[model samples]
Target: MSPILLTEDLTMTYHVGKVDVHALRGVNLSVAPGEFVSIMGPSGCGKSTLLHILGGLLKPTSGRVIVDGEDLAAVGDAQRTDIRRRKIGFVFQRFNLFPTLTADGNLRLAEHIHGNHRSKAELAELRREVLGLLGLEKKLHHKPLELSGGEQQRVAIARAVINRPAIILADEPTGNLDSENSEIVLDMLVRLNSQFRQTIVMITHNPEAAAIAERIVEMRDGRIIRESQPDRGAKRG
Candidate 1:
């Protein structure tokens, strides 16, 4: 299968006051369809920046970001935004949900913004499938505050994949949860990969969390230091 996401020599720089903070310096990665890949690094590493660029949320200072065959740099900002909405799913560490909206409402909001809103029947059908898949069918009417942190995160994941994106970009998805909650969330992600063949590129800082992936790529000082098919070796943080 063709790579669902690819980056070549990606870089990003930030001007923090008078200092130049190089967030990313020539990073590279490729993720195939139906595969789960994790990027792990220290706090200052550019793993999240790589994900943002891959998702087209942030423009790269220089390099190529090709997702589902479209070169992002080739598209205008408006087109890039459309592609991000339609083709890529994003799950962040903080569950970015509107507290006032019910879980179902949040999912509907995504559909409306995507410009291909589903009919009531279509949305209900999709919601049933997704909620069943995420084991969240019962919590659809609950607002964010009524649910646990892990449950809210699951809702966020359901929202992301409601459109059947070509790739899912997860940044520290389990960062806020306790070990038990983290396991629950991670297990769902693994099941999503195993059962539906969802393509995933996740950034994590924890060795245990990163181990859940089929492969782990380590980043240091803004570049890929090494990659391990740790289906075998000692896991790294």
Candidate 2:
């Protein structure tokens, strides 16, 4: 089977004022279905840029991003957006939840945006299952402000996975949480990967967070420096 996500000679350059800022320099990566991988790097190392490119949020300057067998660089904006909505899910450092909507409302919005043809009953069932999986079944009526940071992020994760996208791109998902909350979120992510077989590519600076993934990829100066399999038995943050 083809990799769920693949990047070949992925290069991105930004023209800021008079300078050319090179964010990615020929990044080649492949993540098989159900695999969990983390990209670790210092700030300005282009990890975030790579994540965005993989998610179809940004088009790389020169290279190919094949997501679930579709070439992102070859599609027009509308087609790209369609592919992203159907095939990719994203969780960012900031919990981009709607402040006014309840947790359930937020998740329902995602389902609606996904444009699934399920009946109302089926959609409701899916929502229940996802909320239960994320331990948010009882928080359905709570708004973002009413939930703790961890709970809010869990809701965000639930929203991301509600449509069962082929791939998930997480960028510093634990960056804003406290240590205790971070562990909860990370454990939840591990469960999603292990039990649900969700293919994930997460960008993080925390080694402990990286340790939870099946593989860790280190990047420096816009290039992959190394890759290794993490010891699953080791403690993770």
Candidate 3:
């Protein structure tokens, strides 16, 4: 099968006063359908830039980004937004849950924003299934403050996947959780990929977190320096 995501010679440059800062320099990357890949890099190394470009949040200065066969670089703003909404789900380091919204309410809000046309019954069933998969069924009516950090992050993940997007772009998904909670969140991500064959590209600095991926990509100075399969047998963090 063709790759679900592909980038060729991706580059992004920002003009900072008198100098041009390059965030990505000729980065070439690809992620297979339903494959889980992790990107590891130091600060200011362009991992976030690459992820943003892949998710259609930013256009590369000069390169090609093809997501599920749609060329992001060639699309207009509205089209890019449409593609992102329909094909990509994003999980950030911050949970970003609304404090006043219950877990179920947060998820339904996402569905509403995504313009899902499913009937109420179908939508409710999907919401319950996603929450159950993420182990948040019992906390459905609880607001963000009522849940623990891990539970809130799980709710964020649930909101991202509720629409069953083609790919999930996770930026330091476990960064804010304690080690115990980090392990739980990582395991849930693995289970999601294993059970539904979800395509995932995660950006992380932690080796233990990166190991959950089938492949690990290392980057520095705005370019990918290496790629290898992680040793899953290593001791957990």
Candidate 4:
């Protein structure tokens, strides 16, 4: 099987005034269909910028992004969005849930935006399954502010995975949570990855968070500096 995502010499440069912000430089990466990878770096190292590129939110200045065999740069904005909706799921640190909508509503809205329109019944089933899997079944009717931070983040994860997307891109997913809540979310994420075999690429500053992934790629000055596997002994330098 082909990798779900491939990037060769990926580069993103922004010309600000007389200076250039080289966000990414020659980042060659391949994420397999059912793998979890983490990207870690200091601020200004371009980790978030790289996530935007992978998620099709930003175009690389000069590089090839072949996601599920569709080259993003080759397609127009509409097509890139179509592919993003169909193949990708994103979870952010802030949860980014609809404050006014219930958990159930958020997932359904995501379904409506994504591809291969399932029937209303099917969509409902998908929502139910996501809620059940994420342990949010009891809180499906709760609004964002009504739920605890951990619960809200779980709902966000459910919303992301409701479509059963080919890949899940998480950006600083545990950044805002307490230690206990962070562990809970991380455990849930690992469970989901194992159960659904969802390709996951997470950007995080926490070494402990990155250690949960199978492979960790460190970046510096907009370039990949090292790639390593993490054992229990792993710690940031």
Model 2: weakest 10-residue lDDT segment is: 228-237
Supply candidate 3's per-residue lDDT for 227. Answer: 100
Candidate 1's displacement at residue 104, Å, is: 1.1
Writing each residue's lDDT as its tens digit, candidate 3 over 1-237 gives 999999999999988999999999999999999999999999999999999999999989999999999999999999999999899989999999988999989988899889977888988887777878898989999999999999999999999999988899999999999999999988988888877788999999899899999999999998999999988885332
Q: Give the lDDT ranking, best first.
A: 3, 2, 4, 1
- Itemize residue pairs with steric clashes in candidate 2: none
Question: Against the true structure, what is every candidate's RMSD?
Answer: 2.8, 1.6, 1.9, 2.8
How high is the CA lDDT of each candidate model? 0.87, 0.91, 0.91, 0.88
lDDT of 4 by residue, 50-93 (tens): 88889898889998999999998678898899899998999999
C-alpha displacement of 126 in model 3, angstroms? Answer: 1.9
Candidate 2 has what TM-score? 0.96
> Top TM-score: which candidate number?
2
How big is the positional error of residue 120 in model 3, measured in Å on the Cα after superposition? 3.0
Model 2 scores a C-alpha lDDT of 0.91
List the pairs of residues colliding in candidate 3.
Answer: none
Instruction: Determine which window of 10 residues in candidate 4 has minimal summed lDDT.
Output: 228-237
lDDT at 46 for candidate 1? 87
Flag the better candidate by lDDT, 1 or 3: 3
| lDDT at position 170, candidate 1 | 96
Q: How many residue pairs clash in each candidate?
A: 0, 0, 0, 0
For candidate 3, the 10 contiguous residues with the lowest summed lDDT are 228-237
lDDT of 3 at 170: 94
